[model samples]
Every structure is written in structure tokens, then in C-alpha cells.
Target: MQIYEGKTAFRGIAEGKIKVYRKDQQQIKREHAENTQEELLRFERAKGEALRQLTGLYEKALKEVGEANAAIFEVHQMMLEDPDYVESITNMIRTQKVNAAYAVASTGDNFSQMFSMMEDDYMRERAADIRDISERLVGILAGRTGSQMELTEPVILVADDLAPSETVQLDKDKVLAFVTVHGSSNSHTAILARTMNIPALFRVNIPLDDTVDGKEGIVDGYHGRIYLEPEPRVREELEARQAEERRKQELLWQLKGKENVTLDGRRIEIYANIGSFGDVAAVLQNDAGGIGLFRSEFLYLESEDYPSEEEQFQVYKKVAESMAGRKVIIRTLDIGADKQVGYFQMEPEENPALGYRAIRICLDRPEIFKTQLRAIYRASAYGTVSIMYPMIISVEEVDRIAEIVGEVQEELKQQQIPFGDVEQGIMIETPAAALISDLLAKKVDFFSIGTNDLVQYTLASDRQNPKLEQICDPHHPAILRLIRLIADNAHREGIWVGICGELGADLTLTETFLNMGIDELSVSPGLVLSVRKKVRETKLGEKYN
Candidate 1:
């Protein structure tokens, strides 16, 4: 009976109430398992149950999005099958009558220990996912389901936080909009919202409890604005905007395959930014010309240990094959302090953004780095696979990594491994990396300027941090200059340069980067066609080529 007003991202409205539930507790009958045989039997039962639950969830995911989209869940299944995830819990249960919380706590401790031994953030994050999943399962055993906000009526979801799985799985037809009191733009939940094209706002400054459930509310996710019950006139205006949004969607369909050349006949490479082999299908679905930047971090995020080179090869091969020889540029692990994966035991620092991450982690862990290199190299045989290193700072670091890459290629050749001759490159992210672009260009095959990090590094502000969020501007003169320098340097050396950051998809920045001489522009799959249209509006040769 009341109306709320706010900037709307997704169109439509629903109303619902909040339902909160606590974590579950699993019953561990320790005393009954005194004998070794009893202990083994108990362990087997627990493992089987966990595997069965994981399998069911994965199967459900496959049905929803198909095998390609379900690929991410495969990693969760692996975690359930992980010896540490299942066995450690079994052991704890057999040795003592620990509740699910205690057992999960014990397993979590051991998980942290194992992660500490790892050097790659990609691998380390997997450990964290395992712990997170395990703890979640333990909560299930303890009857601790997620806070189930009541949806007796279609209502906007109000929560302190939400899981990506929950957000994606929510009945979009019923849920109107989501407003979170706390979350990040990079969280899986946010990614899900973007994927679903849903209107969602994260890090809302106001508390959800401030507005009583069942009372009308409004959220404008794009502008980060909200309104309590508004005047009837305001509601009428919102409904009109929603209608206009529908109109735009209809018009956007005209952009498909319309050509991505700028107004002056300058062609630009518009590709998709993917996280896993699963996302390759989305790229094709969206008719993205190719894969721009494939974040290899997913391989680490869903794993307990370093992915075997052979394992990585299969994944890379699937993506390359799916792309059908279209360019697939893979960026190596970019894990760091703020992105702490349970497995990478980095000494927590006050400033994780500036601390050790990306190239820093790779150099410190050569063996792990080489394993990934070997995998990428092997996959290169299947299709056009170019490798890019992230978070490089100094020319010497580039030299060191390039030397290691050379060693990998030589080893592959000596071993007679089936691999393609892959191109090697570095991401121009750090201020140091940008300043030394000429020096780095002399060492690597190409460059991809990660403007997101470059902006943060140049401004000395952590984009991930709240206080500095306002300062993380990609258009800042310093950031623009750094990107221009790296692009100009790479082209001067006859090496190609592309941008795989958020800025690439930004329509406003398209002409700017094009003017800076970027050859490729990688962005989210949904934005590809639009960016391509923007490119076709520019004259490449006359402006910068």
C-alpha cells in the first residue's frame, strides 16, 4: 500500500519479509567408534554423504545452466572429494565427539595450515573455498541454513550479505531487487547480479533493519541511492523508467554483429573476459569475437592444492577449442593479500593491495609458476593461447619471469611435450610497471594494461577499500598517461597491446583507448557487442593507427 523511490537498475518490483536461520550442528558419535573398524566405517559414511550432497548440487546446477555453466560447481565437487575436506573431518569425528562446529573448526585450522604452504593466490583461494564450503556443510549438519528471508509475497531481498549461489539461484521472476548493507562489487553475489542483468546494490550505507519488512522500499543500484515510501507521483515516474528500459533492450538487439569498426573504418578487437572454461560458452552465446582475458584464478579458487599441469592443460584446451581459434589471452594468477585464499598464508598486512600479489607471488613460487606455464604452453598446441603475467613492477622481474618461461619452453621441447609456440607478455598494472614499459616491452611479447590496478597503484589508494573508493578513477590523468605509455611502448616494439580491465568495456573510454592505439579491447561478455558498436564509430587509422 506504500511506495518507495530510488534509482532502479533492474526493472520491476516485488515485496517480501526477512527470514533468518542459524548454522546447523552435526551429531558426531565418537564413543561408538572406538574400534579401528568402527572408525573407518564412520569415515566412509560421512564421506559418502558429503559426496552425495555435492553431486546433487552440481547436477542441479548443470540442469539450470548446462555443463558449460556448471563447470564452476565441478570445483566444489572436487572439494567434497578432497582428502583433506572429507578425511580430516572424519578423523576429527572418529577421535572425539565433536559437534559439526568443532569438527569444522578443526578442519578449518588444518585447511589454513595447508594454504600457508602454497605460494599462488589462485591455489590459496581454493583452500579458502574448501574451508568455506566445508564450514557451510557443517552448518547444514548443525541445521544452520542461510537466513531465509520470507517471500510470502514477491519482495526485494534485504540482507547484510548474500552468497553468489543464493543470489543466482533466487527466482528472478519473484525477487524484485537486492539491497545489501555490506558487500563488494567484486563479490560472487555482485557478479551473479551482473550476469543475471538484475538490479542490485551492494555496500548500501543504510541498515536493512532501519526499514521494516513489508514496508515498501526502493533501490537504485547503479547510482547507489535508495528511497523509503515515496509520493505516488514518484512511483509513476519509476514505472515509466522501467518501461523505457524495456525499450532500450529492444533497441540493443540491433547491435548484434553490426560490425565493431569505428566511424573511420578502424577495426577493434572486442572480446569477452572469462574466469573459467564454463564462461567460454557465454562468450560464444554473446557472440563475443574472442576471449580477451581469461582469469586463471578460478583454477586456484576452487582447489585445495596446485592444479596439476595436466589438469590445467585440459581446462585450457577446452577453452581454446571452444573459442575455435579466436584469440584467448590468459592472465596468470593475480592473487594477493586482500584476496586471501585460505591456502596462501600471507602475513596479513595493513595494505594488502600494495603488498605482495600477482607477479610477486609467481616469482616467489617459481615451481608453482612453472607448473601453470607448462600447462598454458601445452594448451597452446590446441589453439591460439597467449599468456600474460600480472602485477609486474620492475624490469628485472620481467626478465626473471621471461627467463623462467624460456626454461619452461626449453624443458617442454627437450621432453618432447606436445605444446604450441605461445606468446608471452606482462600486464602493465603497477606504477612501476607503467614507468618501465619501454624496458618491459624489450623483454615480453605484448602488454595488456590493467587500468583497475594501475589506477589504484598510481593514486596509492586501494580500490577495494571504502575510504579510497572515490579516488579509484580510471580517467585520472596519471592513469591515462601510464596506459598510453605502455600501449605506445608495446606498439613501438611491434608487439600488440590490449586492455582487459573494466575501462575497456566502459563506452566512455572506448574512444580514449582507441586514440591511445590499443589493438584489442576485452570486457564482460554482455558489453562486447556494445563496445564493438562504439569501435565502429571511430576512425582507427586517422586517429591513432
Candidate 2:
């Protein structure tokens, strides 16, 4: 009977049998030369079936299904075309002459072996993805499930872990909510659940075998709690809370069409921090001002090939056109250890966040940096494009970045490329970035404080690590002071400062940022209306002291 509280992202209380998926699937038998031809036959059949199932997901009827429910479909598509995966399996089958199942098994074990040696947790976790996809292929070859799990009644998926592919195969209309023993906030499965607006919780770290077998219990995704055999009083309280949540959500929807003007006639802008075109549509639907954080991570994810200048330009152009006249602040290719671009070879590090990430990577690879800058500058002609650099620790970084940007601009001009004037900026994530605001202010056009990482680094806590997660507070006094310094410095220099982080959505900090001279707040699409409502309620000259 333990209770935990967190911001309610989704409202629902469901009770169901916990179907756990704990098997890594990577520890399987390898194929030998005697059965190689048979394994190749099996591999081709599985590959073809994988393609067919993927095709079915796109067949208009299935296309409209929830993204969380359609993830396996996408993963299967990747398996069908992934040369690295397919070739490895094919080469093993041809060279070793092993049985079909043994060949797939061998390939899975090889991938798992390789991934386990890698340092990145995310990449290591991807080994599970490989196993999951390979097992699905094996299942398809055996006529077992074919990515379809017969979830008859509403059930909470209780698992030690759930992969993005497994979560995608969930029956969305029937799924009440999901509870997992292990997963982070940024895990693809958790992200997909959020995207589908499903009530899902992770990092439970509890055995669901006895607690959730057949007994009636409440799985509260909002609070990340499980009430096993709850009393009537608890049920009543939950029902009341659910009702209140519904009312609040209705109010948020009603505020969407309304203006976000502050008391005393001041107008404040509310924008959405989006990562892709799909996100742009969501922002537009929510009536956001424009895109604030058009993270270029999606481009890196979509292709193994380094997105050429023209390829990058077209993507940026599409986002710009979608925004129409609204400002689209495009953050230049923010890449590093955390977000590894497969094509680039990077040295492994003990600490990825403090390691070669963002501007640090760009500085080392000037040609790569120049290519992205050139693409951004070229895209500026199509719409309002602002070039932003991530993780700037000193003014020297900004100066070097600006120098590279100028070089790119001159090169583009020499080639007679039509590009517009793009504003340059830096993300105030590090304490150093915020502390030296005056120096950076002189070198950049503006600042967008990424408070998520800022709070983590400022507090000396790893936000992703469960052990130190409790100390990663955005509300800490030091973080607030740094944010204030950044905002004040930008304002004094006649440049605007905006926050593109979870802090922007925090009602308690909204007025604090405004009082500190912050110009704008960029949050998720679902939060825009509520934050806008809060902004309208704020008064001028409200002292934080």
C-alpha cells in the first residue's frame, strides 16, 4: 500500500493480469555449416513475411491505428530493408551452412554479443530491439504469432521491460495501461505510450507475479502507483481524482481558441518544442505560435547516410513551409555520444553528457558542421530559420561557431546559393553557459535555456540514473538563479530569451521566469493551452523575492 505522486500526463485506472516480457531472446543457439542452405531458405521466408506484415500495417485500414499499436509494423519494415542485419544473417547462412532457426539464432547471439560490449546504454538496449525483431522473424517462420498477440480483455502489460516493437504490437483499443519494472522516461516504448496518450508507467522495480496475477488492483499510470486489493475509500478517492482530471482537460481544450494575453494588455507568446513533421502537425493542431526546438535528431535517426546538404535543406524547407509565417527556430545538428550518428566514428566516453556532444562534436568536425550550417542557411530563404548551438560552455565556443557559420555563409554566397539572414543562438544548458551569459550575449543573437539538462548538470545529478534522479531538481535555487542570469543578460543585450524545457510548463516557475525577464516559453503541444492560461493570469511587476 505505497503511494507515489507525479504530474498526471494520462488519466486512467486499470486492473489486469501482468504479461511480462523478460527474455532477452539474444541468448539463442547458433547455426552450423551442415544446415546453412536450410537456414537460408528459412531466412528468405521470414524476410518476405516480415515485409508482408509491414505492408499490411500501411494498408489504409491499419494505417489509422495508434502509433504505439503500430510500432512493430515499423520495426518490421526496418528489418526487411536493413542490409546490415539481413546481410549478416545471409552471410552466416551461406558460409556456415547452418539450419534456418540456428542461423537467425546465431545472428541474434552475435548482435547481442557485439551490443553487450558497447558502452552506450541506449545502444546496448538496442540489442534487445535486435533480439525482439529477430525473434519475431523466427516466430513468423514458425507460424507462431506474426507480431499479433491475442489480447482478449483489457489488461495491464506487466513486464520487466517492453521494447518499442513489443509495445507497438499492443492492442491499443483494449489496452487500459502499462506498468513495467524497468524503463526510463526517454525509452522509445515510454515515448510511444505518451504519443498515443495512453496511461503507462515505468521503473516500477517490483515483482508483479503475485501482486497482479488475478486479483483486482488499480494501476494508476499518472502517479506510477499500483494499489493491490484496494479498499473502498481508495477507489472512491481515485474516481474523484479522475473526474477532476477530466474537468481540467476540458478546460484546457476550451482555452485553446482563446488569446494568451496577460493582465494589463501584454501579449505573451506560447510555442511548441517539436522534433519532426509529425510534431509540427501536433503543434499546429494545438494552435502553437511556431516551432521552438526543431531538434535535428530525427534526420540522423531516419537515415544511416549522413544527410547531405540538399537532403537536410529539403527537410528544413518542409518544416518551414508547414509553419507558414510563424518563426521556426532550427537547432543545428546536435549530435554526440548520447545521439550517435551511425556513420560517424566516435570515441567512447565514461560520461556522454559531459563528453563529446553538440557543439563539441561540431567543432571537431568543421566540414560536418559547415554542411549543416550551409543547409540551415539555405533553408532560411524558405522560412524564418534561427541557427542554435547546443552545450556552449564558453564564449570561445560561440565565437568559433559564429566563425564557422560565417565561413559557410561566404561559401554559400560564392556558390550563388539563395539564403536568408538567419539569427544565431546558443542553448543555455550548462552552468558555465548561464554564468558567462554576458560574454555569450556579445557573441550570439539569443538564448534558449534547455532547463532539463541544465538542472541535471547544475545539480550534479544524472537525470537518467534512478539512484541520483531524486536530486535532479529544476526547482533548485541555483538553477533558478542561473536561468534568471541568462534571461536578464539576453534582455539587457536587446535579445530575447525563451525556455524550451519541462520548466516552461511548470506553473509554479512560469511567473518566476516572466519576472526574470524571459520573453517566451516553449513546451509540449498538450501543455500550450494550460500554460497560456497561466500566462494570462500572471501580473506585471510581480516580485519573486
Model 2 scores what on Cα lDDT? 0.74
lDDT per residue for candidate 1 within 332-434, as digits (tens), equals 9877755555576678765666688888898999998999999999999889999898988888887898799989999999999878767888888788888
| lDDT scores of the candidates, listed in order | 0.69, 0.74
lDDT of 2 by residue, 63-157 (tens): 44332234344544665567887888788678776666666766777886798577566766667667666776777766675444557777666
Off by over 4 Å in 1: 1-154, 203-219, 225-232, 342-351, 539-545
Clashing pairs in 2: 33-96, 33-97, 35-97, 35-98, 36-97, 36-98, 39-100
Show model 2 residue runs off by greater than 4 Å: 1-33, 44-120, 152-155, 204-217, 228-232, 264-266, 411-417, 540-545
TM-score of 1: 0.76
- Which candidate comes out best when scored by TM-score? 2
